[model samples]
Target: MSPRNKNTMLVKLRNDSQWSSWTWQQKLRLHGKHGLTRFFPNIRRKVNEQYIKYIKSYKIEITPYLLSLIDYDSQGNPQKNDPIWKQVSHIDLLSNVKSADYNGVNLNWEMPEEIHYSILHHKYPDRAIIRLTDNCLGYCSYCYLAQRTLDKKRKTLSSSFQIKWNGTLEYLRKNRQIRDILLSGGDPLLFSNRRLDQLFKDIKDIESISTIRINTRALTFNPFRFDPELIRIFKKYGLTALEVHFAHPKEITQEVDDALSLMDDIGYRPIILWRSPLLKGINDSCGILEELLVKLYERRIVPYYLFHYAPYSPARSNLSTSVKKGVRLLSELRRKIPGIAFPRYTLFHSSGKHDIPLVQEGTNEFKYEILANKQYIVKFKNWKDNWVIYPDLQDN
Candidate 1:
């Protein structure tokens, strides 16, 4: 056999063995900087002083499967320009400001007043979000919930919030206006099969709740997590739709395809939908996004939303792209791909989620203005019909 084929077989066997034997806890134990070096020798030399400092400031928890996707050089070191590496790793040059909002208390864009227990009653009456856990298998560099996921102390729901599962269910039961429940957090798929089974059963019991949407990134992070039991649970609950986060085309690996095939084989084929933030230098380009959306469409996944990167904290400001840039990219994409493959370019603001209008010939809602301090800003009407001014990230 060829050396390349032999190496491929060996890797497959190793992954299969690990999946069968290692518990999620065992896998998690191998996370962080040490795990990167130990599992992949290519990353050892790359773990320098800057990498150490970045991890110190922001938590690093990447799954082994996800780390394997990053491209490495002939010297056995991770490529600095690898898209997968850029998504997970922190770059010092991108963010220089140290913000005090690391705790994530003020980062709640859902608004504190609307929160009842662990439930976030969205400004829209139809849907509400339930934060299952403030933990994920891996941490994305541009995650809006960086404060909650990065800080180990706040992994669980805080006592001050008085959040409880029972209370959340009760709130949903009482509010007949809520027809949809979004199971979100660091990622709801991180829950065990037993926990997910019970959670699904409880949510199913809600007569008023017509749909339950789970937002997760597990499909890319660790496709092995979607074992037979999880598929069984999904089938039993009749869950047809799953919102997955896939930032780049590189994230769609053979393992991810196998997981989807497994689901299909079991007759529990989920209607997969994609949602991702338009991060600067990550997936901000027309070609990159076009490829990602087209790939997702080919796999029968709907391209749902391409979000404007939220600068929740000063530390994450570098990842933010100009809203105009995002719109322009989307506009360009509209001409290149099918309408079904096109994703809505959206902005999650303090007011609510708003779709940013593209640059068209007709009268547009977007207005550019210069402030007294010579700061550039964009004015757009929010969900509440109130005009809101957003800082333009052109200078950044």
Candidate 2:
């Protein structure tokens, strides 16, 4: 059946009185519209029962807005350029390999023993995270939060603190060192404007918190979400910066341009920064990377960190490229692109963000050593320590 038919059948079956008041996400769940099954039924059928099994392992969601951006004609057809296809699509990798936590990032590991809140993860001394919601407008295949949020047994903060931010605010108020609090989660933009305004207002009152970074991918998922009202709220709170993820150039659409234009026109105190994983098939090439960087620069958005793809999730193993290749790409970009356009390439570890050596090695042979202090030691075979080149370290 077509997606429209499936959705129609789903809507017709709902008998709950609160259905009308449900948010976009609630409606999606009521209709089983969380994964590839919601669209391209033929492809889902082609993969057979394995598709069902794969989503059962992970909560793979593609919002209707993001779903509309996918180039169905070119999807899975290598002859065409379908960067969006590679990003959200499920492949043989998910079915063949069992799910494994590759990055080792867990809520428990970062959370302090004293804090009872699930929304806060105080990993570093000066920075902390306020996981607003465990929900997102769309789900990326390579999301770092996949293992934590997707697990049914795990309770997420997506809905818990919607009405109040007292717990997190109190914690921030007491700990003045936390200058920044990243509003992250499935995507904090998914929350209603009223809820968001309240959340930011509470934080804005805290004198110690100078920076409020809004982490979201809604620019690609649903650019219109940044309406005038939302922009007004953001301005009211003195939003410090916006950290947006754009894995491939294809994800940058006319709508994204307009959304960015809106932000520009609004004259925000918030500086926009671009960040994305260095995915193998999606954007490993220098040509694609340069184009993406140029586009972001055109929008006055600064290129930030390009994180090395974490291979922990079996679903995105195919997307992970070698650190050597990542280094070469970064080095080449530095040579060709302007210094301002270059994003620092780095690896994220449990300890903190570590610089990925920009060393140009002859072969792929490399060894990694995890020191007792949680620092990493990576050495290229047949190369002396003098050959290693390190990028300027930055805390994430």
Tens-place lDDT digits, model 2, residues 213-278 = 999988776676777778888888888889999988878888787777776788763788999988
Runs of candidate 1 exceeding 4 Å displacement:
1-16, 19-33, 39-47, 54-57, 91-95, 98-108, 119-121, 152-155, 158-163, 313-315, 360-364
Q: Each prediction's Cα RMSD?
A: 3.8, 7.4
Candidate 2's error at 30, in angstroms?
12
> What's the distance in Å from true for residue 146, model 1?
1.7
Q: Model 2 — which ten-residue stretch has the worst lDDT?
A: 387-396
Q: Give the TM-score comparing model 2 with the true structure, all chains together.
A: 0.78
Give each model's whole-structure lDDT: 0.72, 0.65
Q: For residues 1-396, what per-residue lDDT tens digits would candidate 1 score against the true structure?
A: 322222232245456646532254236433555655554455455455566666655667766566566665554455667777787776453346533223355553657778777546556799888878787877777777766676544546645433388888888889999988888888788777898899899989999998888889888777777788888888999886789989989899788888889898888976789999888788888999989999999999999999877645434556677777777778878889999999888877767777888863213577867788776667888777788866666543
Candidate with best TM-score: 1
Q: Candidate 2: misplaced stretches above 4 Å?
A: 1-38, 74-81, 98-116, 162-164, 361-396
